[model samples]
Target: MLMVALCGAVAGFVLLGHSWLQLLIAGALGIIFTQFAFLAHEAAHRQIFAKGTTNDRYGRILGTAFVGISYSWWMNKHSRHHANPNRVGKDPDIEGEALAFYEEKAVPRTGLRAIIARKQGYLFFPMLILEGLNLHYASVKSLVTRSEKPTKGRFVEIGMLAGRFALYLGAVFWVLPVGMAFAFLGVQLAIFGLYMGASFAPNHKGMPIIPAEVKLDFFSRQVRTSRNIAGRFWPTVLMGGLNYQVEHHLFPSMARPHLARARLLVRQHCQDHDVPYTEVSLASSYGTVVSYLNRVGLAARDPFACPVASQLGRR
Candidate 1:
């Protein structure tokens, strides 16, 4: 709450100041929005409240209104991800798009898309510069395309998103020159996207990609597929408890404050069960993700090769 208040105050002051240099505050606001997004994510998981309805209410407000993302869209997609992390054909996170998490997804790529797939690891961070825009676009797209489905708070989210963008864009245009306003918005979105991608990409990207047909117990599925960033204070604060991703996956409803202790318990349990528990430094995890993506990209370079061979190479 204090941070929220501080962010609003600083943003208000900076907007009224009319200084180009104050665009830096826009970058800071991006980081702040990502923090709110994390809170929204937790709320959606029912970690912030006892009742599911209460959590949904707050999740909608924080995600759609404050963070300019659709709670309904995120909830549906993220729930699927939690239910099947890194599982082929099941986990939406690993679904083939611009970047392929699994090798087979890369095999059919051609032309520029193939080029991107081949070097996606190196371009991942740069690609994330558009993630903020992508999130907003995807949220609205989900709502529009899935209108026939019964979505809780669908119209309400649309209204909130409309209002949120109205006020945000209104303020930006009102306070700054047209050119500067665009630049300011660009910086904010870029930073928000980059930070979000950086925090999330390390969690499961380099970890095992489970076959869709393979059935695993909950403990094994969550523990083996997730990787933890080794840290206590700063990582927890910066990543919004995402650094404790292994523990987070095991206990989706676990509150941020308890994740650290949960990590120890989860790690010991994994050790006892002889399950692979991955914990690496933040830097090391990033390198692993990049290397992993590059290896998957190799499939695009050789389209005729056996997919089984590529899968074997991945292991």
Candidate 2:
């Protein structure tokens, strides 16, 4: 079903011939690609295929080759994230080199970067244009230069990705003028970026930021730190069953189809154990994420503004 939709979208983009219709097809392609991304993510966690190796093999194509992302790189980083989400200095998601998501990383900045960092919450959506591109670049780079040891199928990965891009760009540029092609590419990538970010960020963005040294049990850690979005089919499809973020985090190997049922049991278990289970509407979760980012962004300008301290105060 997913593969067919993707092929149709891509085919329409190439065969439509007309520039305006091609642009519409590009939008469909972006949404379809994001769904492919979710499937690839599930594959990385061994949810799609029973065997890790099988999932990895297929995931490489869905992610690195067809989807233009590196599955190996995502797996390595995502494994760490699953093990210790929101942990400062550990979870790769919140790397502080550029914009800080947590109070610990929001020390202070100077110069133009600081000015931009101050408004990162607002800039986050717009910055995703390069983010989609960066995903491809990082994936290839990780495979190409992994501690000089190099990945096993590095050449194959490179060839597949090159072919995918060649076909994609070849179709676009061939079917349309150079300027329209660029515009089409821009819209497609931007939507992909926004779709990707919008899906994942709300899962943990506004939730508690665990300290690097904190050691909690698996169930507690996962449930406490992750937020679930309340919805059924559309949200599940869009989030790739990740609306049950807490459940997904707790059971990394579980299949996406089973996540919804599992969440009910997980929620009951958490209540039995007196653990806080954070769940909210999709809109609510996103609002919290935006509020959290803007709140943390305040710390960039005023050293006294600390979200961590504020959380403690509320507690």
Best by TM-score: 1
The TM-score between candidate 2 and the true structure equals: 0.91
Return the clash pairs for model 1, or none.
Answer: none
Candidate 1, overall lDDT?
Answer: 0.88
Residues 92-188 of candidate 2 have per-residue lDDT tens digits of 9988465779865664665666666667777776776667777877877886775855566778888888898998899788878998899899889
Against the reference, the lDDT scores of all candidates come to 0.88, 0.81
Error at 195, model 2, angstroms:
0.5
Error of 2 at 234 (Å): 1.5
lDDT of 2 at 280: 96
True lDDT of residue 6, candidate 2: 78
Q: Residues 89-160, candidate 1, lDDT per residue (tens digit)?
A: 999999949798998899888888888888999999999999999999999988777566788877898899
Ten-residue stretch with the least lDDT total in model 2: 298-307
